[model samples]
Target: MATTETAPRRPLDAGPPPLVADPAALRAVLDGPHAAVRDEVRDRLADQSAILDESADLTRAELRERVRDLVVEFGAQGHAALGFPPEVGGGGDIGASVAAFETLGYGDLSVLVKSGVQFGLFGGAVLQLGTRRHHDAYLADIVAGRLLGCFAMTETGHGSNVQELRTVARYDAGTDEIVVTTPDDSARKDYIGGAARDGELAVVFAQLEVAGERHGVHAVLVPIRADGEVLPGVRVEDCGAKIGLEGVDNGRLWFDDVRVPRGNLLDRFAEIGDDGAYRSSIDNPDRRFFTMLGTLVQGRVSVGGAGLSASKVALEIAVRYGLRRRQFEAGTPGEETLLLDYGMHQRRLLPLLARTYALSCAQQEVTRQLHEVFSQDTPDADERARRSLESRAAGTKAVLTWHASETIQECREACGGAGYLSANRFAALKADTDVFTTFEGDNHVLLQLVAKGLLTDYSSEFEDLDQFGMVRFVTGLAVETVIERTAAHQLFERIRDVLPGGRDGWDQEAGLLDPDYQLAMLRFREEHQLAGAARRLKAGVDAGTPSGQVFREVQDHVITAARSHVERLVLESFVARVRALPASPTRDVLTALSDLYALSTIEADRGWFLEHGRLSAPRSKAITREVSALLRRVRPVAGELVAAFGIPPEALGAHDLVGPPPADISG
Candidate 1:
């Protein structure tokens, strides 16, 4: 975890040109193709700015109602229809919808969570999992906020293992109905958003049975509440106050033989016919289950985008405050220095600023892929493409959310005690985003999924998610651990192919700042880790070691390989984004930031690089020096970098945290 020192070993390089960049140009790049959506959301948030300030003062019940009201307002305004199909009264722009969701992160996170629950998760489930009949019956009302709902998939006994969920939906041929029931307390749906108070219906995932044949898990619509009353045969309980997101009505639910018409089943992927036989086009239960879940990958993509936006909010607040707040004097006699003037403070916040930019590029790419996959006519043919998208989404979500948690906490510490105060916003930012790492999918499990996909090269249908299947599959493969190139691959290849004498030239200090060099180092680590993990699995399997024990032994390696792969993708995305910008101070500034992000990440993991023989002892230390030097170059533009996030002043109230302005030190 050691990072660059505040003081560098040598004099600072002049680095990029002066800080003459336009914040608008930088904002446009960060906003990607959906710049209009971001701007619209910002304007909407500005009009309701008071909620961001007043949320902390409201009681739990009051806050819940306030968030609910705002969601309804958004729905009534047609904002919630952005992600749905055009035929269903929607704007039919999937990427724009995600962009809007990301912008929502600037406001109260409780409201963000509630909005995500309704539009992103619950509504997404109905749209993606349900067939034409189901969509016609529910889509318009759901989009208009007339029909509230919950995506009740996770049970107490089974969350990550969705295939093993115990809740059951049995089709009764005699009654022509589907009976849903929670077989045990553990089978009860827990942590269901909107279940405690507002949800009128639940899209419940349960094992489907017809004529003694079980057809894996499928979604069935069951009424949970009516006329503000808990419906018959359904039980609900409040999850009470938590560390954060108090505005979201998280709850638990139990169903006691709840019956609905057979047509209530979301039969897009599977169905029961008039003959009372379970049927699905996908023969394998595992393939069908994954396909069903893959359709809902938008939830993961939205969470990652929201997490990135939160990081932007935190960085903007901390950087601006650092620019204004001053402490002990260092340069002038009796003149207090700005907090950002010190090398230590710059090292702390500037690199994080750089990383936020990198993640913005990656998030935009993921959102673009999400839109492409969902907009197609034959979405089922999108199986391979969807799997790839899902893998990247999973990896990106893990990294982005983890970065949000880390960046917010660091920003809080950088601002000193003022950040701890309720009015400053860090407390809320930290508390609300802490659960992001686990909610959509646990970070560890998600990363392992990314690694698993990489290992199989997406050849298998992902029939077995267990450790045994992973080791067995890996051992069976003729492993190809090649590094996939980024969109800027040719340029990277030119730089790499021209390097003098490979390792000898790679060890030079100048190469430390090169984009190609940074990418090579990251790719090298990822490829090495992946190959090593494959070898270890093969070894264990060859020796007839139990699959569980073999997997446990290599679990750390598996996760590391996944993390390394994601870091490489993030850097590549940043580089490609920079290449897209025209030659100007804006491009120069972004290039410098891309360098900082790459080097800082390399520096943080220097030990791993060193242990793997990828970096010589002296070369490893040079990366630290390069990071410190980049920090000095970036220090002048720290304020400008954060401002480009274009967060409305009303949304980031931390301007009030610095008290009165102190003496300027930049001059």
Candidate 2:
């Protein structure tokens, strides 16, 4: 059961009090969490506002024209193929590329997603999967928008299970050409952003067949159109307009017998020799495929960053509106309450605002990971580091995009009728970004991948501990048990000091605020979920059940594990960023925000804690109280927290927040 704090009654003549924040400190947050290449993308946004506004209201044809215009504009400005090699006409900064890519969301999502599809996806595939020859042939043109291309990986029928794609690239040794064809209608490339118009090329993915043996999926650069006309063996049809993103000419493509030189294969990992012998540099096909996929993973990070920026826009609009809009007065004569003064209103938006901050920090960490893993040639790069990059990208993309979607809706409702006005921006923001949950990678499917990664690693440990390895295994378990007991005792002692009566009862508020306590709580839930899932799956395997059957049995459990794991990542990232801040009132407020994020997250999922006896009933009851108080603490600074996103004045649709000089409400 939960209880809400009541709002204080105000006098009749009161306008909403001006609550302010440290813009300088907020600017630091806008710079992101870690010490790395601080991207100037947001700074450049002030100049792009007019272009964004121009594109926002265009018809489909005009929208297509705008996209084309932007392509050339971006290319000329050296912003198009930013993440590619320097020799290939790019900025040669992948992290900055993502940061700049995300900044596009401030204008229009159609533009952002379309940009991602062209540069990050299509050109990225050519860069990551293709060899030096392909780069020499197409890289410069692609970056210049002289050669437009599609990333033809997702078929209509095999978006999630891409390993089973029906398209084939059959090698004809006599012709020294590879013939690419879609097996059937189901294999048509669908939802391809640039395919409807302007695409001259595609990096089509299909199974490779050589000497009558089928190899796993690989990509080859195929010409789909020439001089603005569909090519001889290719057919393209528009996806026929949708709910939003009208600017992108999304289309479907069906290939009949497209032929390209064998050299066109993007064969960085696996290759076909001149003698027609198929071979891969990496012996493990799974490892090779995953590695290729990892190179293109910048798309996921880009999408998450875009979602984060959109969340900021939404929160700024809603919070600013909340500050200015006044409603019914039940207390003082003639006085109407500012929307944020209501406890219910704070409960609704503050937590979501908190989530946006958490996501902002998490996305920054992911950006650092992306740079660390992708920048240099790390032949001996730790496998864990790469997996961490990919997994974090996947998990953060799923979490933040969903957060954006949900937060946008809540913001819309919070603003009532104004949110529905097309000019207000929320309507467009909601409609356009609705697909981010499914784009790049479907959030649900991507989350499952995160869980699978955990399970795969966990299962490997179990598999290695076969009967012959029992002695080592038993010793490991004994060591783990002892460690758990020792750790638990230490935690209990810490909790005792915080307790008012020294172990007589809990200092529930102090316990909740303690970073150590929060981490331990989050750790326990995630480990509990992972361990439980692992045990269930293992039991099924031991019972001689089919592996697929075992997987299906624990699928939901693993999803829960995945969510818990990602939530822990956000909270941990939040705490780390809070700790890194120089001590000041700004640090203190951010610390409170960090606590709100953690405690509110627990409050939402309190059932699990209660069910597992991880939290006592009395402590659980305090979770709500503390969370309510946090909402109050965060209330005064909500607008400034969002302003930290550095959204340009033209990009933000609301005005009340900016009209007043931001005050130092951190006091």
Candidate 3:
């Protein structure tokens, strides 16, 4: 018979800690290095009447127009120019740009997506992928929003597999022009933001052909609209009324041999010369393709940060509601207990809060890493470093977006009937963030890409290979099965010494709370999952299994390894932030929250731990109790924790649900 065992609960009278964290201190920590940018965005959102007003009453056309105007307004204010270099009339601060975009997630997501399309995707392509000629002519206009554009990369048949896109850009030597063609129906660019309306041009991804030979995929600047009219040889169809994000105009596009000057090619990595000869600094086509794509890493990083911000907004709403919305009279006479005081409610919301904090720390780290990589005089020269950045960006985007989807839905449920009401903002939040999981790159595919990078150790040739080829490569490849300890080795070692038998030692509450122990558990799981995946691939290949079959069978394991790797990275990032803080009530509170996040992550995957012998049944049970205890410790300060997110009340758009501000229960 199947059975469930509940951990013994601590008494309700246990209460909260003596010192509660100051909301301002926590806000400083969460705001991270680009606090000024976040604050600026908050200030802007507070005054945006169209966005702050009741959007439900607006028609789709009204919503789209409002969002469009907002994007143009933001661009005029230099918000869109933050990521580009100053030579093109930009602020030349990559981190600040991403921070601003991320902060925008607190307001209407339609505005966020529309801005991303114009600035991050379209302008970014021109800045990063195009050389001096293209930039000198178009970039200033792009940043100013005078020349709106779309990143026309995904085809009807190829979404993530850009290398396989069927659209072609054939160099016409006689006319000194490039003919861009959608070879078939499948080659049509689909779900392109700004394509249905408003875009005057597109940075089109097409297979570049010169002298009857292909040079892989390359981006070309093709004009799609002129004088408010669709250009010759161009066709567009509106993808009207989507599941959400109606404020952004998404549509499909087709090119029937559209011709543009040969000089319109991006040409940063690969290009066609005046004599119709294909030229590139990178000889390998695969490397060239990915290198070109890698320059857009900011898109992934910004999307991840934006997704995490959405999670923050959702958590804040749920947490604030949980603090004031009282239920059955379980405590004093005639007075109902606060919803957050209940064990189940705390279990539901606090762990999510801890995770939101953890991911926020991780987002800060990734953003910093991105700034370092792109700020270099020449960012793409270091191939391995570039690939590493790409891998981390992919993993972070996948995990953060998936987390956003889960957290928003859970928050909606936690608020119960109030959340179900459209005016509370959960409906829009839930609908809008649903696409984040599949944006930039689909979570499943992105995770698999992460796993591939791990198995191959970020090998330069790995991106050159397809799925079957990847399986073949991993079969004979030597793999790293051990966890590489971070710079804090001594701290980790001390924690290990506490458990006499090194991980096998029965159990202790202090040990479980140790950051080192939490990291060790997460690291073990990641390493074990990765090693197991490698062994499975080797066995399948050695037994003469077909390469495709072998890969198909092990795909799930590969994704699991990738997810484990990302989860560990998130935890390590959180622990590092907590370690850096000076001793204070804020630090103490964050430490407990970090511990809760770690334990909760482990508890969720305890079955896997027990199967792998890293944890016993009773030890797993102890983790449950510790998580509950941590929840109670965090519950009283829950309001302050959410307050630190610094989301403007106007942006929250749920004033009715969150009625009057309650007194701080932390005291």
Candidate 4:
């Protein structure tokens, strides 16, 4: 049999270099390789036309109304119970629940989040952490939406620190009851969804004391109200009016010696026996705490998906506005230039577009990992399961929430004064998303958790090394750090010596710009952060401090390192994605996008480079010039880039038609 020979696959070509590079030089690299992952995402998006369209037109008020309707509809249809076990009328696939839930992000973040709270948060907590008995008795009503519930873990005093919460659940063995009380004003469960008016049940988190031994934090099912009346000893207070998400009715709850049956305790992870004895499958207190927390990782994953959706919306709005809105018209009378034609505008927006793209890829990876762990087919080891969940939760949560905030703000600025208008959507989107940074674990605190995980990994590696091996490892790290710092300093100095002054200087240096310089600079920052952390750890050891406190201090440094690492990874991913595209008129535009992303990152962290002697003043100037140049080069393709987001016209809805075409010159 004769075998057919095939041509080698070529990467997608990004079109012409922005005014900065020689067209010949640009053409040479046009046939570079493409990432299969991008194609998969593109194809996935292609199949979801209707969902994307609905996502685009979704507004805050409409979202609120529709969400309320969904709550009622799901309740009536019993659709809310889809993710639970078969015995309790659920599909028994938690991964499917998350997958379907993530798709809702394409609709509107507010709607997705509210739905998440109803199904994933409120209903999910009861299903996963609650016992089979609890599921049979209370899960049905909660899932059907007959009873709205809230996951009450956060308090005014202790936000990310769940263990420090003051809500107490003292078991009264004589009465066969537990008194759940919020001891002080700060201890009240604050900012709980469904607490204000809708919720009839709450998975209240509080310190559990069985036979006088405090058992850290545990979940208990509490009846908050019946028939619109607050239950005895339960106080419900509305957290009225906020910067954003006003429709969801977030509120505070105070428990004053609230008497709940001992059986109401959702003790799947940590149990309290009928005889007032506390027992747990997890021996380590810390492990138990994390395992319980990990069960709720779905919220973080959903938040990430939501954040990515929001970023897409913002980018679409800004890019559309850029293509339509006119600015300086040089020679033609009454003929305004498209906002995107301006180099500055591209500089401001395109990299954020790149970031949104990168974040989407990361979110998909996180979702996949989450699905794997939750999948029944996979052999689940307890430790590996916890790490997988925690890693996805912490990493994606930090990345996506931060991306939402930054991208929204950038999109707002991209649209200029119009972006400030409420009707334009930027301002409202920003306000609504602002809370995302703190919710589902504050970004800083979440980063700290990520940092702790890294330290643990590092410590484990440290344990395997002998004394000489340890010394060699430290030496290798130091050498790499020194070499990176030196190389950066030299490159920056060389660029400064060659490049001219002012805008003209920037234009010339732009041609000489190498993307690798930025990557190198970032690497230096990572090394610096790592070295600083090591120094701190050493100091703590010398002081003979408690291991736990020492670990916490080291963890803070690790968070800084992790952030740097994440940023670097994003830049690398963006470049890799760009390199994989097929050659077309749009290829050069994509390359410019890659450049814009890399340079913007460097520009954003100019201080790091400057502080570590990685970048000289001249090279920094070149970075600004090159980024602006790339932005201008990619301007004409902004529409195509947003279009490639593959959002359906329905999701874009009226917003898709709100603006005129870029080529429409009737002024």
Candidate 5:
């Protein structure tokens, strides 16, 4: 149980760059714009994290008990229903709900996900897809930790394809009840968290049938367990151990003629009438299904936000270690250089730090949109905004989670052997979050969702998004590299730069800082590639290919287009945030980090820009050079930037782990 307490072998490195590394200052940056909610949750977790941290030695049963205790604690604080309506025993502050969910990642990932499944998925379904009847009856208990439940949506055969799940809920006209059944093994709910032990009820999703009419996928609450016993006709099996999140008791469930009151149907969008007929507010089944699932978008955003938190925590640990872990002498003989002083180490971790900061900013925007979309009545909500929020949620979940995976792995490597040790936190952080790329929804599938939104006249879909506003604002800019052709804009600038000199429309420093420039390039990439992909898809269809085949032909392009949209979202969000900070020297450092995030992302994707003539070769080269320069500019503030993450000192681990007791030689 003893952790390696690494101690500093020598004095600390010379003063870091001027950006504040004060825990409070760095924490302020990590907390983003909503400091109050973010800090409240963060400080709460920091105070009570011991109870939440899962150790390697705990058995599955032990972990489950620990998780249960944490759930009780969360419920006691009313966090279980923070996003639910105040009328339904919740605070109705969706933003605070999301903040609390994301903040839990600073402790244990298992606990983080368990909280998500219980509150975000289970409670959210009742609150979002159900009417007054379900809420008035179950909301208080669910929020009070008196009714632990599972969200049984995914099946062995339909992990991502919810529409095709074979689980059936047939109306029994004579009894005025609904009978839920799994046709076979493939239809059993797979990976149902809380099912193995704690869950007593479930929000079961199945294809509902009334009068032989099939309703796509609908959720209905079914009693699965009572008095600590599995209900009749309900079978549950533990998923057992996993590579990580052992503290979460994941399991599978099967039902055989599980009957519930017909009112069990969460009939917010659709319902069955007493006359044995099916009815719905929305006529189209596809749209109705999407509308139902759309209410659960906060889960995806929460997962993505959790991923960011994990990354921030990992970076804080590694970068803090790197600042103190000394290696072979470089400039001064016998005076070892700090790990962070090495450019190689800086390259390994700093950009990731910058990227995490960018994602934090983007997540803030997504969380805000989530609050705005769900805090009010559905009918009065903006359809455009809803779609935009879904797109952002999908894109952010896909991109940010992937970023977390990459950042965590890089952080481990940057810390060398110390990162691999259990005590140091890297192993736990990486193992627990390794599933992030596939969490909530598979990254590829999520990206495809965003792509579908873009191909469906994205200009209109994104018109309400800030990215579009930035695009319009950038119509005229002090762009760098004028007279050089990239595309339409370049040609226009070329005409204006007649017989060029320094007077040409090139201002490298100013251009990189321009919000107009960053957003325009990002939007241009998104629009152009989407248009190309659409053309390819249309041509494939015209050639008499199956719709699925046509989609497959341009799948990669579809993913690329989605990536562009997400990158634009991140860049726009970061810039807007940086620009909003009060004027100060620290603000300048943040602005530099924002610029680094933009330029580095652009540099990574420059080949696409060059291929599409969006960025001429020279301009593309300029982006790389600028990115390198920003890396150096950011180096001095690297410690401060990561310090801003505000990971507790204990989690940061020791600078030089006390070497394991010198070889027990001379036994």
Candidate 6:
């Protein structure tokens, strides 16, 4: 039902005019019908900004006072408890929690990460994986901020390699207790929030050893502090000054054979009996490990949401600055051009703007899927639930976290030199966001996990395809890949064949940009991923490698393939949304955004298309030209696009460039 459309004939000297769309229109596209939610988040952010402004130059004690003041406000309003269980004193909706937390992006990254450590990480781990007993015992105090909690998972030596952690929880049957200990300095829990100050309890993760057989990682409740003093056998040391998030007292925690009741274990998947015996509902150790890890996928989802917010803030600052900042004059005498008017500037920022939108849409989809699994029962079996959760968790976490890092850096650069200044927020945001890539599992490692999941799915779903079916799928894939590689060449060739083009022919060719072509290009990328995976797997097989090593190699290929597939899917979703819109200036703006996304992807991976003989040299050139042109068109809408993310001034704090008028300077 779908087919590629070629550009129409055109005259030599004419091309499509540059795009222009206002900030308000861009905001409408991002907020959609969820304007009220955006507004609420904006108001909260504004309040936070006010606090930052008030304490801009305070002492360490004064700063802590300000942080405590803000924490009190956040605690009193129950804003920090958005994503917890309703039964355990939470909002009961993961989506709502993420949405509200994202607004925190407009404020300080330090505040956002600190708050995330409290609610999303510490509180979330317990609520998602712990039983009702654990919930009743600890969730209320955590939610109310009466007892701050820290998530102790990452050790000094083992970061992404969580399965190899050295921290141990050996059950002591004589005392009906579990002896939790740090075997060496490398085994100490490093970089734990709330551990340095404020936290009374910790959700400690360690190797579960019962009856002498070691099980995989599991979580347990360990009290590290009470009555404003450190508990016996626990050593907490400040992490000291860092790049950013100074307000958070992130620190290292060492447990010196601390003993707690065996019941302290938060066992939803794996448990310890009264006699110090270990039992698990899961049979497969690997599956059980993933099941436990998947329970905490909310951290990734929240990070994604937070990343989007960070990108949005950076864009807002850049766009606002771009609109007001002037540079060399062009087109009109003595009138300096807006920074956004420069093609190079647009090239740097507009495509990223489109990407932010794509990321936002993808984030919402991930959040929605998470809510479905957590809140409602699906028709599939329990194993299916586990697999689905694992896949989504891996995919979303990989995509969103990477996007956040990339987008923030791009935004920082886009703001020219001002972006690097601490006063501008970019530098601070960059510092705080740097650890996101490493935390909640490293980006590359998470992507490999997604890859493994994809391979498993592919083997399960398509391993039995008949020869004819296999042939058809491969043929379809190859054809799509060829088309993508040659799209620019194909467009230019078709146009030149019909009408010897100058600017007019180029303009007509540009009109050939349609939803069907976009869809086809997307399909081509997906096929390329599959083909690449197949090639890698075949290479490994031909080398006579061990099955496990070969499988790992195959997994890396599959994850890269899966990531490409998901990226295309996201672009297609953005294009679909654009097509569904009524014809307007806003629609035109969205169209440019969609094009930027698609073309940039194609540009990034032109090699595959070229090697596969999908495109000719002329077509490749055309793609580059078209991409540059689209960037130029989207430049005018850059400010509007970021503004659509809907962050409020207060949450951004004193660092925000756009804030309310000072009381002393009355209008």
lDDT per residue for candidate 6 within 137-175, as digits (tens), equals 888877777767899999999988777889999888888
How close is every model to the real structure, measured as TM-score?
0.94, 0.89, 0.95, 0.77, 0.88, 0.84
Is candidate 3 or 6 superior in lDDT? 3
Model 3, span 461-493: residue lDDT tens: 677877787888887665443223222334444
Give the Cα lDDT of each candidate: 0.86, 0.76, 0.86, 0.66, 0.76, 0.69
Per-residue lDDT of candidate 2, residues 1-667 (tens digit)? 2222212222324522343468567667766542132334444455555555565566779878876776666666677666778898787777778777877777667767777877888888988888889889888988887777888888989997777788999999999899999889999999888899978888898999998888888998889888888989999999997888887888898989888999988898888899988989777665666667777889999988888889888988888778777799949999888888889989989999888878878888899889888876852166677777777899999999999999999998998887777767886888888988998889877877776555554232332332223223322343334235325445645756654445554544555666667776777787677767666665666677666666667778878888998998999898888777665566666677788899999999999989987788888888898788778867878767776766777767544333443353231
Better of 1 and 5 by lDDT: 1
- Candidate 6 yields a Cα-based lDDT of 0.69
Q: Could you give candidate 5's per-residue lDDT for residues 1-667 as a string of tens digits?
A: 4222211111113322444334466567667556676666666676666643346667778877887887777887776677778886788888888887887788878888888888889988888888998989998888877889999999998988777899999999989999999999999999999898889889999999987878788999999999999999999999977888888889999999999999999998998887778899878776678778888898999999989988887887777667667899877878998777777787788788888888988999998888888766673277778888888899999998899899989988887887787877777788889888887899998888787666553443232323223222222222221112134345334433432233254434335444456666677777677666666665665677666666666788879888988998898888877766665556667676777787777788888777876677777777777677667667766766766765554434433542221132101
Off by over 4 Å in 3: 1-17, 478-495, 498-506, 665-667
What are the runs in model 1 whose C-alpha is more than 4 Å off? 1-16, 463-465, 478-497, 500-504, 658-667
Which TM-score value belongs to model 4?
0.77
Error of 6 at 116 (Å): 1.0
Span of 10 residues, lowest total lDDT, candidate 6: 658-667
**Cα lDDT of model 5 overall?**
0.76
Candidate 1 least-lDDT 10 residues: 2-11
Off by over 4 Å in 6: 1-29, 32-35, 51-65, 331-333, 377-389, 458-512, 546-559, 579-585, 650-667
Compose the digit string of candidate 1's lDDT tens values, residues 1-667. Answer: 3222211222236444465657789899999898998888899888877887888788888988998999888888788899998898999999989999999899888878988899888899889888898889999999988898998999999999888999999999999999999999999999999999899989999999887778889999999998999999999999998999988999999999999999999888888888877788888888889888999999999999889999998988888788887799777899898888788999889999999999999998988889999889856666678888999999999999999999999999998998988888898999999999998999999999899887777776464466578888888865443233232234445566655446456667867766778888887788778888988998888999989999999999999999999999999999988876666678778888998999999999999888977678998888888788778888887777777888888888765674433343232
Question: Where is the poorest 10-residue window by lDDT in model 4?
Answer: 27-36
**Candidate 2, which segments miss by more than 4 Å at Cα?**
1-20, 33-40, 43-47, 50-57, 378-380, 458-507, 654-667
